[model samples]
Target: MKKLPHYQAGVAVVTALLLTTLAITIVASLFWQQQVQVRSIENQRLQLQKKWVLRGALDWARLILREDGRGSNVDHLKEAWATPLAETRLDEYVENGRADTEASDATLSGQITDAQSRFNINNLSTDGVINPKEVIAFERLLTNIKLDPSLAAATATAVANSQTKKTTAPSGPSIVTSAASASSVADTSTATVTNTTDASKSASNTGQASTDAIPEVQFLRFTQIDDVLSVPGFTSDMLLKLRDFVTVLPHATPINVNTASAEVLSARIAALSLSDAAAIIASRDRAEFFGLTDFKQRFPDKLTDVSANDLSFATNYFIVAGKIKLGRSTLNFSALIERIKIDTKIIWIREL
Candidate 1:
């Protein structure tokens, strides 16, 4: 090679350094891009897994309904159902090679109910007032269940407030207070008056002092459950606790002792503990309770407050909650069901 000038040699070195830098930059960029692509793929896979798990939950719910002979009435949105599971069991269900036998153990739950029974608090306003009887009965129901007294008071106030019309400005201050003011004062003075009045009226009408009398009043329906949050002592935790077993329906249908879970039955009858109620359910699952008489026969002393005439084995309403978990993903699903005697026909089916 011919001898190069000093400036030419410097230019050659600079060009080589730039080429090396460019090559390194390109390699680094490719590596980063590959990592981003991998993360994106993983995210997509996780989403797919979650979707599949939800589908699995639906399938599990369907199976439970079908087995219970209540599959035909799975359309109602207020029915009650539940299944709890461990995380390890959920992982096994998501895996392909695992036996389907343990699939039931994968956290799944479901419920069904008639929508009409519950009072939708959202519907009530300063204009539309709830029935006084309904308010009293609801409060009594809460009290019977040993819910926080403050919550019950708050619920009554919310309902009353919802229906109360805004008072017109007084034409002039006078000795006689306005009707609205008087009513407000009265409500504050006698919070329990409504319950007492209802009990007396019920006793008068039926000629029997019965604990079941309160249930006869039209109940708050599905949408109304949300209104409970407005009640004074009702916390998010309280609402969650009550959500599983209760329903607001257009009709005041009695809860079926046969199908009602221990949590619910215990709420209805004070003497029944959750454990004792569960034992009763387990026993009845093997054989249907013939009647309240039979129930009394089983636990004569245990069921002191509840009578045979007050109980029913036939259930018209149910709730089912379904949860499915696959891999790291999970889905929660709920449905209300009504038991109707009719020819079987499918109505609506959602995959996820």
Candidate 2:
């Protein structure tokens, strides 16, 4: 039983320290691996929950469409559906896993349109020629609502200026003979002048244009509404106020009086006063105008300017939006939808 040398003792101490360090490193590595595994499991669980929530939205939409009985083709994907999503409470559905007897927030929210309506400004630039009716309608819209007088004038001037730029004929145009060409040019000029004069006259008739004028540009989309910023008197504040009420759709769908908001009705329907628009919205809470006939009955006086041919009850476009929260994650998605009737079944047309 002899005692170990001092040098040997030092070596033993160093070996003990090294082993202790190795053990700690192994324990730390194991702890980190366990944490990673826990995180992975949590993420998977959240993803599944999100999927369920999304499925719930789809099912809710289907149920609403079925109840409406507007045909299976009711455009459930439109903004009307999304408007209610944010306001709906999901507690009952999440807790019971079924629609409850009490009206749920999710149920109520599934009914309103939230997306911006389309205004179809592409017609304004067709073959580089603005449709005269559209021009008249647009000017009337501006005038009907008493939009910025300067903006109206500027837009008119821009349109007129754009129309006036003339293209010169080729120098060697002997193919059709000069006399015929001259006659064609004279007729063309006369038609152009007539159109310009007619548009001005129509604007005057509608009381949409003033004798005095300014300069401005027409917009075609929500993003392009900002183009008014380039106009001399259109302030950013004014454009912001107007953005929510306007849209540019791929094709024009006349405003449905039943669905049109106060802003839209005021701008597009000449006979609808702001008070009238407010009354319509108020009436919607108690009973919606189920069809154009119903709307006509409600506002018989206003119906004079709105023809039966110009009204619609069926809507083709929709916007669907979903918000999901699962565990620690939240997600939001929005989609535009179109209703297409195929054979006997209706289909929702989605972009991508």
Clashes of each: 58, 18
Residue 47's lDDT in candidate 2: 65
Residue ranges of candidate 1 with Cα displaced over 4 Å: 1-23, 34-38, 70-147, 153-227, 230-233, 244-253, 259-288, 291-312, 316-319, 332-352
Go through the candidates in order and give each one's C-alpha lDDT.
Answer: 0.54, 0.55
lDDT of 2 by residue, 60-151 (tens): 66555334444533222333343464445566555422245654323223333523333333323343344565555555555545675345
Model 2 lDDT-worst window of ten: 343-352
For model 1, residues 166-195, the per-residue Cα lDDT tens digits are 557769644536889878767865866878
lDDT of 1 at 26: 100
Q: List the lowest-lDDT window of 10 residues for candidate 1.
A: 73-82
TM-score of each: 0.48, 0.53
